[model samples]
Target: MLVDQNDQALRIGPIHRSVAAVTLSDLSELSEQRGDSFEVLTDRERALSCWTDPDDDMAAFAVSDGQAWAVLRTKRTHEVDATVLHESLLPAWHVADQQVGYHHSLDQALNATSRQPGLVVAVRPPTLAQVMDAAARGLRMPRKSTSFSPKPRMGVVMRDLRDA
Candidate 1:
């Protein structure tokens, strides 16, 4: 949760609230199905963020290469179990531990591992609301599940740190 140092309480900026389900499938297979224009995310649904439910029409999603794509959902239950969440994502985040691949975007990773047997791919970015709800429900998502957009790149206004 990268936040403004000045903001003692998080109340502004692009706050994430949901995450996308992980899709482990073959790159060539997905590419043949959805093509390059495949998007990994979609709007909220059923009051649930990150498209937690698997819908026929995938508004957003992530993919991995293998023969078939096995869709995986949030490893953490409504009950927050930090230990379990970390273990599930350890393979992707740490390559030294296992022969896992990580990519900036799901598509890129899917493309790279097209020939591989199977792997974990695709993770929807969680929204702030979803994150809070998960916490309330005692569930904890994997780290880096959601990425907030940076402040305006254009320097329209300038303020000194002392003044801010």
Candidate 2:
């Protein structure tokens, strides 16, 4: 079933999900290396404000260590995908490998900072249209790139063999 605005099931009680990344790398170091590709926002409040407005082309990077937060806007002229994060953002910050951990919720990501020295990165979830387009083009999205709600319960649709 389509999950876009046209879907009536989605209209009733839509499920919302967010993804955040926690890395041991400091924000300052990342900024110094990829300054040209990102827009840095030192004010935590401002960075949080920017996140309130969703944009497919933009992702917010925040560090609780006071180094500052950065926003990365995709350079692609057409549709954007998770590749921007897997290919550019994560690598630029030096967390392309196991140095980074992903949280399904923002709160989890924010709280992780107190336990270690690191930064948190939040990105907009891919839209259904984007997922469909990518599939049509034979492209595979990175892991944890999207989350959907109202998942089916196990055995909810099961039937006894004898009944059939």
TM, every model: 0.38, 0.64
Candidate number with greatest TM-score: 2
For residues 54-137, could you state the per-residue lDDT of candidate 2 as single tens digits? 444554433343345655444433344345667766666556466566666656665665566565666556667777788899
Per-residue alpha-carbon lDDT of candidate 1 for residues 1-164, written as tens digits (9 for 90 to 100): 34574764343221121122323333334444433233333322322344344433333333333334333333342232222234533333332334544455544554555545445444544445766887798865655454445444575666677876
Q: Which stretches of candidate 2 lie over 4 Å from their true place?
A: 1-26, 35-45, 52-78, 154-164
Candidate 2 differs from the real structure by a C-alpha RMSD in angstroms, to one decimal, of 5.4
Per-model CA lDDT versus the true structure: 0.40, 0.54
Candidate 2: Cα lDDT at 138: 97
